[model samples]
Target: MANHKSAMKRNRQNVVRRERNRSNRSRLKTLYRRIDEAIVANSPEQARQALQNAVPMIAKAVNQGVLHRNTAARKISRLTRRVNAFAQNS
Candidate 1:
């Protein structure tokens, strides 16, 4: 219910951006969960593989502004350490 034309256009643009950002964020969470599941499964090989897949997705999320660079880097670092530890233990 935007009375002004510009307001209506802005509303449409916001809807489109919201959908795109939501999907991107959802994908990031799903990827993160996959890595977590692999870690919890107690299979180092699977965990390492999942981390490999998740890292790029996380980086892309950062690049897209869905996540901050440090946040993504921290996630990657922690996951890498966990995966490395799992590999060493296994």
Candidate 2:
């Protein structure tokens, strides 16, 4: 329902960006779950590997502006802490 051509274009761009952001968020959640499950299963090696994969994906999300830098940093910090604790205990 955009009257102006530019507005219509902007709407289209928003739709595309929305889908991309949703996909990125979904992937992030999946990675987080994988890490959590690894930790719960008491597999330090698997958890560490998942953490390795997750950190870069999270940093990429921050760089892409899908996630705020602090939010991403906090997520990375918590995941790292969990993995480290699991490693130490195991």
Task: Note the Cα lDDT for every prediction shown.
Answer: 0.88, 0.97
Per-residue lDDT value at 10 in model 2 = 100
- For residues 1-90, write the lDDT of model 2, one tens digit per residue: 999999999999999999999999999999999999998999999999999999999999998889999999999999999899999999
Tell me the TM-score of each prediction against the true structure. Answer: 0.89, 0.97
Backbone clash pairs in model 1 (N, Cα, C under 3 Å; residues 3+ apart or in different chains), count: 0
Tens digits of lDDT, candidate 1, 54-84: 9999999888888899999999999899889
Candidate 2 has a TM-score of 0.97
Model 2 lDDT-worst window of ten: 34-43
Residue pairs whose backbone atoms clash in candidate 2: none
